[model samples]
Target: MSDSSFLNWPFFEERHRVLAAALEGWCASHLPVDHSDVDAACKGLVAALGAAGFLQPSGAGAGEKLDVRSLCLIRETLARHDALADFSFAMQGLGMGAVSLFGTEEQRLWLEKTRAGKAIAAFALTEPGSGSDVANTATLAEKVEGGYRLSGEKTYISNGGIADVYVIFARTGEAPGARGLSAFLMPADVAGLTIAERIEVIAPHPLARLKLEGVFLPESALIGKAGEGFKLAMSVLDVFRSTVGAAALGMARRALDEALARVQARKIQGEPLANLQMVQGHLADMALKVDAAALLVYRAAWTKDQGAARVSREAAMAKLYATEAAQEVIDAALQLHGGDGVRHGMKVEELYRDIRALRIYEGASDVQRVVIARTILGEAR
Candidate 1:
């Protein structure tokens, strides 16, 4: 079993431990769902997670803020059992994060069905021309007679095709660059919004390219305010970025577990592989990566829960280190598994594919390095 000792760490509280235990139990019974049909699997997982109340923490009621520690712990645990489960749960929070953090009472009402898993949510910020350049967002949201008309294409949107609602960032021309963006809560059924294409990745989830051609929304659909989309999107990322690291930590832990078992079971030179010093060294390195990643992940989460306003530096560090470390740990685990590691059904093989996208999404490792550097430089100024 993966180490439960991390729960005893001072970074967590009694209630956090309770949540971890309860989620672990629930995952043991319900996870590793069929993936033959990835879309169907995600839909079912969301509903099951909602019915089980595990998804409650993804959203907050009025006057409540998201508990960062809880989000991280749940994601870590879910990822350990099934990466898809983690995706399903994480998207619910990220997809609707803007609503939870900045929406009006009327806008946030959608949280009811979202948190209940009856409705799916999506965040649409990345566009065809801009990936990390939030300021370069080209999607235009033109003020209309009664509402706004959005015209742009968004690619690599999570839950893009399946989501019931999307929080789209578009240029409102309030000012130049980042300052001119605005956010809107657009329903997927809007007349002008269409799924341009479905993207297939090494590890499958419901990802899509979306085309919005004059999609119209009433003024009430505005999230926070016009010209605040950049700030709002950053704020939402501030909360969810650390959780990405938590998911990586979970995958690393699973890789370590699989490695430990492989080392003990496989024999070499007529002795168990665990007896070999070289093999033990690999095992040690894997364990070290997992622990180090966990520490950074939880530290970021705990710092956010302490109400730091923005944990960008900490979250960037956590996301960069944990994801890179998990990639190494999973690679080592696969190497130890010998040729079986490359086989289609092996857990390590699945983890290998699963961990790659973590390093790229949320924020690429190199982008995180830039974030950390910029934060330190700005502080010095």
Candidate 2:
């Protein structure tokens, strides 16, 4: 219900507009309500989206390639309707991002099943002791008789307990820092792999701690080359980070929509709340932030789709600006709602919780700032 004029920006094409409108209608019919059991709900959502032919953009086929703009459009629209739905859709793309970008024919087969909703996928790079510092990952993968033995833990993994396949990263050598790591594709039922614990957050989603416990993976489990794990992980994040920003923009737009409806319907003293200067000021700020965030989000998505080998700098800026702005916009929305904003089950209340995680995930806002600075200063290139 927010403005659609932005879809006409140079960053988008006629197809993107068509995609947004179609997905918007589909979400209106399919994803209006919230879910209680995050795990089961996400699984159901994955199946539903795949049945609807919406998850194919997450993976590429023999003659097909991923279009990042479509990924952003679907995420933005789905998020506008429901964040859990967005999460369900986002994970499908993000979990399969490496495979979609670098997987061989056999790996692509798994991605095809994931796109069809036959299987669930997870990206497991963050460990109990290593997060932003990928160089320090403790999960070790050792060369063995037939394959590799993986032993360690990965925490804060989305789709952790329920995923059918995981794109896991582990240290395969002694090279210093991020050089020795490698990527693997391990099935959920693999021997010695266990979901050690489930994590409950303020905004509920399926998250878990995985204990590999010396699980042995076949040589086929490898995704890219050995010692390319760090590079692959960063590459995947580079592509999906802009989509994360798009998702935040959707939530912010929803918050603005909710706030607008509230203010117009709400009265203060003797006149409508919209008549008050203070309320109008809040609405103006929220609207401004939403537009600004949308620009950055689409710009990054556009840049990626334009054949840039990497959009790390653009993605970092988009994610940083959009997520931080979303927090502010949702906060203004809550303030506009007054006491009702904090009231349980209120839309603004839900948005307030949902927007917080955006700032923290994919890469924290602070980390994004560091990335931006390094790129600008020529420290990273």
Candidate 3:
């Protein structure tokens, strides 16, 4: 059901081909874990991914940088097999991305554990009020006697309740709006930190709302420099946002595969459903979407890997197109399945749930349009 032809595109290297094949084989045996207990399933997937060495690319080693193409490939494959598996693998990179990109030598110790799948990691940037308006983040990190006292709320945080560490963003008041924000590495057990609510989404990801009365962190807990949180967050998103598209691509590909299979297997009026002209057209459109999405997703990733300072515009385009395209592709597949598409225990049903959040998270589709518009307008000026 998976398409391997895309791996031959110029955007990928020989190493990427090898990595995709190897990970695909691994996922065939390990994915689609029991999700009845979402948190436990995520923890198990993370540990399994870590032990298998598939998670090594999630974080960079000393003097090493993250390979975006590899990250995208791993995510695509995992998502194709299991959305939960993809989620587990992705959070490791996203949760610790700030540290991997800008943390001091001492702070990277957490990277070792996260890369090894020994600990869970979370990225806490979304607040109840801010949503995509990151500049409006109201969390405060006041300088105390020895360290900073963080007091704010973070909602819709991934890997929230079970995370061992979090890359949390808060306002340090160094300036105003986005400039005043800073990133910190706050351990989950820190005093004054509370999981106020466990948020259940259409997809069963481990999400939570957190309240911090006065979570204290030593000077060492800061990631990068003060007032650099917004920069750090954007940098991390620039890297991971494309991978989100890759994940969506994976799901879309699965949808196409499922649609093809269903069409050929099911019969209508004493003939295979696939024999119908309309079905063929639908299949053609689905295939077209998947391929176009693949092109954009890898283009952004390849551009970033080539050492462009920031692929913000490319990343946003890739993310927006791929996710939106995936949703369309998946819905077409589900429609092709007739009633079975929505039936319990169906893969397409699960994918239908999984592909939705991709559009909303990281950066919403509307936000991507704004970013693209601003970049082009700024360049025009």
Query: Any idea how many clashes model 2 has?
Result: 0
lDDT of 1: 0.93
Residue pairs clashing in model 1 are none
Model 2 residue 185 distance off true place after TM-score fit, in angstroms: 0.4
**Model 3, residue 147: displacement in angstroms?**
1.0
Residues 1-381 of candidate 2 have per-residue lDDT tens digits of 689999888888888887888788888788865487777889899998999889988877766767888998888888888999999989989999889888888888899899998899999999878888889998999999889999999999999999999999999984877999999988899989999999999899999999998899989888889988999999999999999999999999999999999989988787789999988898998899889988888888888888899888999999999999999999999998999999989988998999898988899999999999989989545
lDDT of 2 at 84: 93
After superposition, the stretches of candidate 3 with alpha carbons farther than 4 Å from their true spots are none
What C-alpha lDDT, on a 0 to 100 scale, does residue 36 get in candidate 3? 99
Q: What's model 1's lDDT at 167?
A: 91
- Ranked by lDDT, the better of candidates 1 and 3 is 3
Q: How do the predictions measure up, each by TM-score?
A: 0.99, 0.98, 0.99
Task: Please give the RMSD to the true structure for each candidate, in Å.
Answer: 0.8, 1.3, 0.8
Estimate every model's Cα lDDT from 0 to 1: 0.93, 0.90, 0.95
Better of 2 and 3 by TM-score: 3
Off by over 4 Å in 2: 379-381
Relative to the true structure, candidate 2 reaches a TM of 0.98
